[model samples]
Target: MKKLINDVEKVVLDSLTGVQAAHPELRVDLENRIVFRGGTPRQGKVGVISGGGSGHEPLHGGYVGTGMLDAAIAGEVFTSPTPDQILEATRGVDAGAGVLHIVKNYTGDVMNFEMAAELAAVETGVRVEAVIVDDDVAVQDSLYTAGRRGVGLTVLLEKIVGAAAEEGLDLDAVTALAKEVNARGRSMGMALTSCTVPAAGQPTFELGEDEMELGIGIHGEPGRKRVPLASAAAVAKDLVEPILADLDFTSGPAIVMVNGMGGTPQLELYILYSEVAKLLKDAGVTVARNLVGNYITSLEMAGASVTILRADEEMLRLWDAPVNTPGLRWGA
Candidate 1:
């Protein structure tokens, strides 16, 4: 209820206004609610784009730039972008090579993006492909998704696939790499507290001070279980264990992320990260590169998610490529 906004209905547009002001290097389309990498599209490079509801800042929108997504569509908070909005982004970002839609596994997102892809191909003759990120090991079906919900692994996938596209890979190659990244990654999340969506004017869910929700989704959906609040180490164990179980990380060097769900602070995130690292090491999982921060978040929710990607040489090389974006920038 204590949100900083002028009006509930205008929350998304108002936030987009701030995004436009804060990141001048990017192009913001207020009407369509799309954010694009400023300037002309790369002639031969595949255009990489993703989108989802608002609230998960630094996600689809914050990632639009060099070595990452070329454009990102912003829907209403926790809502899917309409097919027309998605088609607009697809058409705008498409150069000669084609466009890649990196959609999460949410049903609404999946359906809308599919419809947009069909429209773009038939109406505009722009080749479009999509990769659905379903790396959450937490649940097979949620209120919003028929399969596992795409969570933190989305950030990692976007960076790697965007690097491939920036390298001038064809649409087919870029899409393949994206699918590979999605296949290799697994994520699990936990929440210490719930968050209030701006329009709702109240918390999405409530959690007792002494309890925590394990295997939580990014949109405040019920997690796998609620249990007594535990230590960082115990929480890390609860998260990392499922991911390790779902995918084998011991085969090769891995890319790991301990992402905050908006409201969690860095101090606590590092504490949790250290414990996660310890667990991975104990399991003989070799971590090559790691990111620890709030790359993807669930608006003001106090929690964290762990994403592990089993990486090979190509993934590692692409991951090391320079990226320039508001949410993640390095080497550029």
Candidate 2:
């Protein structure tokens, strides 16, 4: 229950205020809870927008900048943003080119974003397309998802697709690239501890001292199963095996991310990454580029997730393109 906040109800708003103050290069519409790049929307450039519940920092919000998301809408912690709010963001960021909504495959998120797209079309004649990410190989059905939950691959999708958009790719081309990225990626997560939502003031779930939950979702929902705690290498095998089984990453270069689920320290994340690298090499998957650390998190939950994206030459080149954002920045 110990949280660094003034009021439980104001957590999302208060944190967004801080984000606005910290990054002057971005524009924060506090009233609408939208974050956009601090410049004119490039003419003819496809607009990329993604949104979801709050608490997963540096996600939809931290990614708003050059060569990434043009705008991000925020909702209450673990809650979907309203359709009106998403519509505002779409209108604000839409240039002559259409806007692409990079929606995760959660039910509420999908529904809300769809509603927003429809509203934008009817009200302003803004063209909108959506690319739903459901790369989590955890469970077929969950509390919030129909097939698989969108997990770490959302981060990779935003990066690669953003680069394509920045390169002036049209909306149709960007949408196609986004779907290709989603199809080529797979993710699996584990949790050593549960997270405490600020409003709830209690842990969402519990884990025994010698236990771990595999195939965990980002919202602290129950994972596929609980298992006795084991060595880092064993845990790495469990995560990597499912992702490899779900996709044939051996066909080309791969982009690998060992993401920390908030409370896990960098020391342990590196240890996990080492094991993941070893396992991928043994499976004949060539790692062309890798990202390690807490890119996508589940509040203060202690654990990590593995995301693997099979990359062709075009995907790899786009990934190397310059990106400048609060969460991810390089070559810019």
TM-score of each: 0.99, 0.99
Q: Write the per-residue lDDT of candidate 1 for residues 183-277, one digit (tens) a residue.
A: 99999999999989888889999999899999999999988999999999999999999999899665799999999999999999999999999
TM-score of predicted structure 1:
0.99
Lowest summed lDDT window (length 10), candidate 2: 38-47
What shift in Å separates residue 302 of candidate 2 from its native position after superposition? 0.2
- Distance from true position, residue 107, model 1, in Å? 0.6
lDDT of 2 by residue, 1-332 (tens): 98899999999999999999999999999999999998847778889999999988889899999999999999999999999999999998899799999999999999999999999999999999999999999899999989899989999999999999999999999999999999999999999999999999999998999999999999999898999999999999999999999997656899999999999999999999999999998999999999999999999999999999998999999999999999999999
Best by lDDT: 2
lDDT of 1: 0.94
In candidate 1 the C-alpha lDDT for residue 291 amounts to 94
